[model samples]
Structure formats: C-alpha cells, structure tokens
Target chain A: SQQGEEDPQALSIQEGENATMNCSYKTSINNLQWYRQNSGRGLVHLILIRSNEREKHSGRLRVTLDTSKKSSSLLITASRAADTASYFCASTLNYGGSQGNLIFGKGTKLSVKP
Target chain B: GAGVSQSPSNKVTEKGKDVELRCDPISGHTALYWYRQSLGQGLEFLIYFQGNSAPDKSGLPSDRFSAERTGGSVSTLTIQRTQQEDSAVYLCASSLGPSGVGTQYFGPGTRLTVL
Candidate 1:
C-alpha cells in the first residue's frame, strides 16, 4: 500500500504539554499534510510541508519533512484539552499521470487532559 | 464566504438498497473530491473532478459506486446494491484550483448505515 503509517497509535498527554507524532511513507511525495479530526467529523487542515522544505511552522504547530528518510513529524506545542483529536498524515504522490490524490495514514489518536 | 456542505447528515438504509449522497462545493472552486471514512480508519479516496475534464475514478472500490459532477458545481455519489460493508461517512472536499498544492475544505459528511 502507498499509504503512510503513523507511529504511536495512541498518545495521552496533560494540558500544556507537547505532543509529537511521527509518520513514515514508502514512496516519494510532492508534499505531506497534517489534518485533525474531531470525533468522526470532517477534518481540518493543519499544515503542509513540501519535499524541498525542511520545516514549517503555523501558530503552535510545527511540521518537518525528511525526504531522504521518507518520514515526517508533527509537533503541537502547549497542547490544550481541545487539541484532543485524531491526527492524520496525508501524502501526495505522482502515480501514472495523476497527482495530488492524497493517501492517508491510519492516524494517531491523541488525548489531552485538563 | 461559505464552505462545502452535504445533505442528509445521517441516513439508515437496508442492504441491497441504492443511496445517493449530495455535495455542494465552495462556489468558484474548480476542484472537487470524494472520500470515504470508515470507523477509526483513514480517509479513502473515491473520486475527483477537475472542472470539465474527465473525472479520475481510480479509487472507486467497485462498479456499484459511481459519482457525477453537475455544471462543475454540485456533485452526487450514488451507490447501487449497497452492502453492509458500504456503510461509512461520505465526505466531500473542494479547493480553489488543483489539489496538488491547494488546501482542501471538507464538508461535515453524510453518515450512511446499511442495516
């Protein structure tokens, strides 16, 4: 499968603590994106990091891409109780002639306690 | 100013029945996509439509699943002879241009239960 796999299927942390999730993919990708889903509802785009970019930050979120290792990580600093959600890493790879069809990871379920 | 919207937020149907899910993408957005999310699972790509070009239906699981975009705006996904395994949340997303570099805005999704 071309889908990526996220480490630590579940993580629990206290409020104000930082949560880090790792993702490893099997193929070369154009970009990797992080998304947060509350319960089973729709997903909210968190951040995107291109292959050429080493790292990017958005607010309290940080994303890093290591193309040589085919791995990526998402770090959420000062996580709050509201940050509890299922986080997924999606990658876009060029297969045949199609581009940008996102293949998602199984996701990491994070719970932040207040 | 509005986001993607889906109808019949929840539906319960008997097996072997046909069902249709609707999605209204953000106005002016040219790229639309459909996905399925099973419980505790990742998003499964279903199909994609880019303006008037042919849709990429490579991710469709079977012939019983099909979708169509109307006037390059709204889209509908129809499932024929639905099976119990077909139960899932049908999600729709749209972006300003090509999804290769754009962020996709998703709808709340339509929850289908095949009993």
Candidate 2:
C-alpha cells in the first residue's frame, strides 16, 4: 500500500512561476524523499528531508516537512519547461529496525508551459 | 561513475511464458532493490537486498515472482508463468546501504509487456 498521497494529482503553470506540490502520509516516517520522473521512465532523486529536519533547500528547490501534520511539500522556484515531469513523495516507515524500502505516492504531474 | 543499469530496455512475452530481468548495481554499493510501476500508479516495492543478509521478499505479490543476487553485484528478477497483469515498468535501484535516509539511484527501467 502507498504510504504517501500527493495532492493536486496534476498541476499546470507558465514558465517562471513557482510550483508547489503537497504529500501526506499516514504513518510515522524516518525520512521523506522526493523524486522526479521524465517521460515516465527513470526516476531521479530530488531531495530528502530527515524526520529531525524541518526544511531543506537545494538549488531552486525547497522542501518542508511538517511531522505534526504528517505532510510534506515540494516547491520549485522559477519553474522552467524542463521542470515538467511527475513528482513523487516517498517515505520510509520509522519501525525500530532497518529502514527497509520506501513506500511511494501516486505522484503529481506538473506541466510547465513555456 | 556508472549508475545502476537494467537489461532489455523493453520486453514482450506471451502469457504463461517465463521471463527474466536483470539489474547491475553500481560498483561498491551494497544495497539493491526492485520495484514495479503500473501505468498511472505509484511504484510498488518488489524486493530488497542488503549485502549477504537474506533479501526482504515481503513485497513480492506471489510465489511466481522470485529474485536472486549473485556475488553482491548483479541481481535478477524472474517471473514464472507471466500474466497480462504482470505487464508494467520494472525499475531497479541501488544505494550505499540499506539506510532509509540514503538516496537510491534508479535505472531507466524495463518496460515489460505480456500478451
């Protein structure tokens, strides 16, 4: 079963606009990671925010995790057509053992119109 | 450095036939994983391997699905008696270790089609 669920199943915006996607999970997680898929093939690692960390930034990407709400959001500033792809949020359960594999969300398809 | 690689970018087979998919993880990486993605669906974990420890096969959907890793470098996922529902993108990934917080590198994935 999918532990996380991305919001706004789909999003569309013009180039240069910032795009934000949200993901909510039902269980306690050790960490939450974001990934991007282009052409529906390979997935690229975007960013990861550990449970103890609240926010992280890399290049033009900003991710915020609200453990209290059991949700996380990905923000892409100055979006470009190249950013057009599917974004997914995956979480690793906080079971008191080996971290194990990740549980992924359905993903949010973002379209950046040039 | 070379990233994870999978064989036969695409495969087409008839139902009831068996098929094998291969994954070669990055050199020196000790963790490997397999996942299945159906059209418009989230990725589902199929199996995981960490070093010499027994692989976690809890995610495998059936007895027909089996996987093995050799010499801690290459892994193969085999499906016995494939079904139409088995048609999906099979993805492979590898990381430095099994830490949940580590980033996993993914391959281009194999598009499996069952007729």
Candidate 3:
C-alpha cells in the first residue's frame, strides 16, 4: 500500500526552467520527506516537512505541506542537468510506538535538457 | 562521519539458492531499515530495527525473507529459496532515531539477481 502518490509520472524541461512535482497521500502523516535518486542507485534526502509546518526551503528546493488536503509539493528552481533524476516522496504514518517505516511513491522522472 | 555501507555491491545466484546481504550503519545510529525496489518501481518496505527492541517485520513479503541486526550497528538480510521475482536492489538505511523524527541515510544498495 503506497501512501504517497506522486503526480506527473514524468516531466521534461529546459535547464533554466523550474520543475514542480506534487505528492498526494491518504491518511494522516507525521511527516513527509522527499529524496532524489541517480542511476537507480542510492537516494539522497532532500527536504522534510512536518505536519505542523506549512512550508520549508533548502537551497533551491522548496517544499510545502497541506494537511487538510494531504498533499505536498516540491519545487526546484533553475533546474540543471545535474538535477535530472528520479524524485520520490515518502510519508510516515502518525501512529504511535516505533512504527516508522516510510511508504514511498512511485517517483517522478525529471529530465532537464541543456 | 562514514555513511551507511552495504556489501557485494552486486550479487547473482541461481533459483532456489540462499543469499545473504549485509548492511553496516553509521556509528552510533540506533535505527536501521531494509527496502526492496523492483525495476521502475517504488521501494517496498521490508523490515525495521530500532535499538534492542523487537523488529517490525510486518512489511516482509514472505516467510522466506528475514533479517537481523547485531549489536545495534550491523544488520543482515537473508533470503531463502530465492525466486526470479526476488531480484531487485536491496537498500539499507539508518537514522539517528525513528524515521518520523529524523532523516534516514541510504546505502549504495546491492543489486541482486536471482537466475
């Protein structure tokens, strides 16, 4: 059961353009985090937004969370070829007592053409 | 300062054979997790270990899949009677605390191929 479902299964844009990816999940969540994977290997943590927080920013990455809608979005500004990779959104349930496994979305394949 | 590490970057075994994969988490981290990713698919949660407490094995696909974390630092995932469908990338991650409270660092992952 995938908790987070990312929209726009794939996207393509120019290097200087901006790319936006959206994730929608069911049920309440404690927090939502985004990760980036290159070459289908290890994933790198990008940013995380807690249920109490509405928005957060790290470098060129901006993340927003809307509990009411159970959705989150990731915006990458000035996209570069280096940013071309698969992006995934994961969410942790709000349950108690150490049940902290993350349910991940299928991911969005972003292609930044230079 | 070292990140999570997994052994045998890649593994290839015949069907019905048993295989073992290892994960060495960062020093002092208390939480470890295992995930499986098929081709062009999202990761599937396998298991989780937090300190000395019992592991959360609810996500394991079958009885053939089992894992253990020794001394709260190193862990191993074992698969008995491997099937072709079991071939996928096995990723290990560790965090300072539970995923709800901390970010998890991932390993390079082992590419397992069951022929």
Candidate 2 lDDT score at position B3: 94
| Candidate 1: tens digits of C-alpha lDDT, residues B1-115 | 8999998899999999999999999999998888899965557888888984545677889999999988989999999999999999999988887756677778999999999
lDDT assessment of candidate 1: 0.89
- Kindly list the per-residue Cα lDDT of model 3 for residues B64-86, writing each as its tens digit: 99899888889999999999999
TM-score of chain B of 1: 0.94
Q: Write the per-residue lDDT of candidate 1 for residues A5-112, one digit (tens) a residue.
A: 998899999999999999999988878889999979888889988889999999999999999999999999999999999999988885556646688899999999
lDDT of each: 0.89, 0.91, 0.91
Greater TM-score among 1 and 3 belongs to: 3
- Residue B46 miss distance in model 1 (angstroms): 0.7
Clashes of each: 0, 0, 0
Fnat, 2 decimals, each candidate: 0.65, 0.88, 0.69
Please give each candidate's TM-score.
Answer: 0.95, 0.97, 0.97
lDDT of 2 by residue, A1-114 (tens): 789999989999999999999999999999999999998799999998999999999999999999999999999999999999999999889886644688999999999999
Q: List the residue pairs that clash in candidate 3.
A: none
